[model samples]
Target: MLKLFILLSKSKFGHPTVMFRLISRLMASNKPVLANTPVPVNKSKKRPAWSMYPKLHDKVLEKLKENQLNHTFNPKDEEHSALKTYDTNIMGRFRCYNDECSSPGWGSKVVAITIREFSGNRYNARVYHQRCRECEKVGRLIINKSSYVDRVTYRIKKWNGVNMERPKWEEYSGPPHDRKLCEGCRLGRCKKGKSDDE
Candidate 1:
């Protein structure tokens, strides 16, 4: 049988098939086929700490921690009661405004904060800011007033410092501004225009 196998392996017509069979048999014998090869073990690839918006990521974390501490201290404050908390883990998706480009919208996280008595205002006013994963590469920041919630409140005192009325919350009736488009779209547009001119 060994002579016959060697003859078949040596024959030009059956050489490939016989060699394949022999390799398969050798591999099935429970010994490592690549015994001479050095295999790397326990080598893990490290992911980056931040994919985009490193400064924004740190700022958001700090703000969240501060808000949590402040909430604990002023649990009963009416202003605190009106504060709205957004899910920081939830990412926002926005499409590129350039119609010619096939690039899909980027993902981002919206951070909204309302500071009470801001700049001597009677009520709490909210500001909206966004940290986009794609736009951050080009150093573009997304800021707009469209997402603001204009809640106005005032205090009234009467007669010997007696608090006649607490701060009243009123909803803003004005129409919201249009949402800002992606800055990447502008860059795409400029490139397209230059190509056309060329």
Candidate 2:
């Protein structure tokens, strides 16, 4: 808690927490200081349990790194299966992680995680990716023909098809196409067309 307050205060005010920490280290190491007026004490704040795990994130990062090395299952994980990878998409649970999926039902989504492997066994990364909501699977690769280029590649990504309840200048326009197609984009295109004529 005290350390977090110090960190927060130090970050906000550009105060020297590192110097203070160094002074703390020096005091701990029995370094002598001049007997002048002592350093002013800073107020400390208590941090929540999740934030105060004492290098928990570092430990997780270390384990993730070790998993990259040796390519072996963790002996410490006695309970988990030999294959420990997991994802909502692989299990075919495309629903959102939110709890309130029942009352209004869920907007269907295809959610999955992707792991990129490397040869040197140093930096492996796991990324959680959503199967495009519209396509209901991982995104698609599209190829467009360009007269100038041999091949042009584009990616079609699935995005949530939610309708946002915002007012728009589309009041002057007719019925809309796909609802997620923003009114702002349509209005901007129309405004540009009119301005070009004027």
Candidate 3:
């Protein structure tokens, strides 16, 4: 009986033997190489960039179409405005035209929009100024004339009188001290040493 079993094992019909016992053991431990089965895998679908600014483009167009007035909140509709609060954690609202807005700094108004065509990683929404038509046209013209330096400079300006006057200089220096100070630090850069304020 032992001789018969040895003869059957020695035959080449069952499966081919290979070198490296560990490799052969690993291969043998898996399922047979039948034609039907394959290993399974899972892949998560990525979210689109435009998904973040959902309906923004449409909202702007709709507002424009209706010719909505700027700077005033309408009980009936959504209009363009600067973002005063963009954070999810804070319990506050952000008007896009608010002075603290990081983009397209236009003016301080709750219902006024101060953004146009802002881009994200995968998408962009056209932010717009919510001023009247005349201001909007002039704003665009200035944007066109401005150099890169000036364009960036333009986004920053006085917002809700936060830095209306330097605390120390407000009383002594008086109003309209220097256009340079206003132009250079439209977003409050005059207080050079007070790094802690930011």
Most TM-score-accurate candidate? 1
True-vs-predicted CA distance for residue 126, candidate 2, Å = 2.8
**Which ranges of candidate 3 are over 4 A from the true structure?**
1-36, 45-50, 54-56, 64-83, 86-198
lDDT of each: 0.30, 0.26, 0.24
Worst 10 residues of 2 by lDDT: 148-157
Q: What is the C-alpha lDDT profile of model 3 across 55-162, one tens digit per residue?
A: 333443333334331222222222233243111000111122211122343331111112222212111221222221221111211121112112111222222222
Q: Write the per-residue lDDT of candidate 2 for residues 49-150, one digit (tens) a residue.
A: 110111122433343343232231122322222222221111112222222112221221221222222233212112122222332322221211120011
Ranking by lDDT: 1, 2, 3
TM-score of each: 0.19, 0.17, 0.17
Cα displacement (Å) at residue 101, model 3: 41
Error of 1 at 46 (Å): 31
Each prediction's RMSD over C-alphas, in Å, is 20.0, 21.5, 23.1
Identify the leading candidate in terms of lDDT: 1
